[model samples]
Target: GENVGLHLPTLSVQEGDNSIINCAYSNSASDYFIWYKQESGKGPQFIIDIRSNMDKRQGQRVTVLLNKTVKHLSLQIAATQPGDSAVYFCAEKDNTDKLIFGTGTRLQVFP
Candidate 1:
């Protein structure tokens, strides 16, 4: 089975600052990668994604970067807000279309 894991368990950031979360995947064959934000007692929500072919992709205030060579992935959030506080996870989709989720990083945004 494929495995995805986070480099850090928690990250704390001040409001209006930037936040970065890191992840690592075991499946090098994975073609697609996705970053998700999960609020307390809620399901994960899609934030951004980057395919293996691309190095980076950006959304409204979020960015996803993939490094196939090192099997590393990262998510960058701009202007962190209280609402942005959540558990962030990175998921990888393999050739079989199976999605493997990481342990998740808890993002704590403080005023």
Candidate 2:
């Protein structure tokens, strides 16, 4: 059987510094990618997204980069803050519109 998904479990960063979270996906057929941030007791919030046609996309203080050749995705956060502390997830959407989420990465920001 082939593997279908992947993720990094945790990341720690210093407040006021930049943070980079990485993810690897197994479905090469997936076309859309989304990054989500989940706070305690809250639902996942949309942070950013990129399409397979694009190699990179940027939002406010966040950036998402996709490498189809390696089936890798990365999220970069500038000037990480306390509010940035949370669990982050990467999701892939196939042509069927089904989204498969990676395990998750808990981002801990220390002051």
Candidate 3:
């Protein structure tokens, strides 16, 4: 089990702007990573993904950058909006059936 206090979730973002989120992973063996955008009370949707072998991955209005050397990662959202607001989560899986999630970033859109 992980520390609960260190793993609290959610991030807040503004409307009509850009947002950058950070994630820290503890497992070195993880080889594949994905960034998912989840709206209020809904399942996660895959936005973008990157392999351990690759340093960067991009999608429409969204981008994921992975740094395996230091086990760090980031997600970038361009021109954020109210509809684009949600909880962003990063998942990692390496030959395992289950994926481990990072502390979620909650994007809040304000008009």
Task: Work out the TM-score per prediction.
Answer: 0.91, 0.91, 0.85
Query: Count of backbone clashes for each model?
Result: 0, 0, 4
What is the C-alpha lDDT profile of model 2 across 1-111, one tens digit per residue? 112112447788999999999999999999999999988777889999999999999999999999999999999999999999888889999989988998888898999
Arrange candidates by TM-score, descending: 2, 1, 3
Candidate 1 on 1-111: residue-level lDDT in tens? 112223547899999999999998999899999998887666788888888999999899998989999999999999999999888889999989978998898898999
List where candidate 1 sits over 4 angstroms from the true fold: 1-8
> What is candidate 2's local distance difference test score?
0.90
The stretch of ten residues in a row with the least summed lDDT in candidate 3 is 1-10
> Which residue pairs in candidate 1 collide?
none
2 or 3, greater by TM-score: 2
**TM-score head-to-head 1 vs 3, winner:** 1
Error of 3 at 13 (Å): 3.3
List the candidate 3 regions with Cα displacement exceeding 4 Å: 1-10
**How much lDDT does candidate 1 score?**
0.88
C-alpha lDDT of residue 46 in model 1: 87
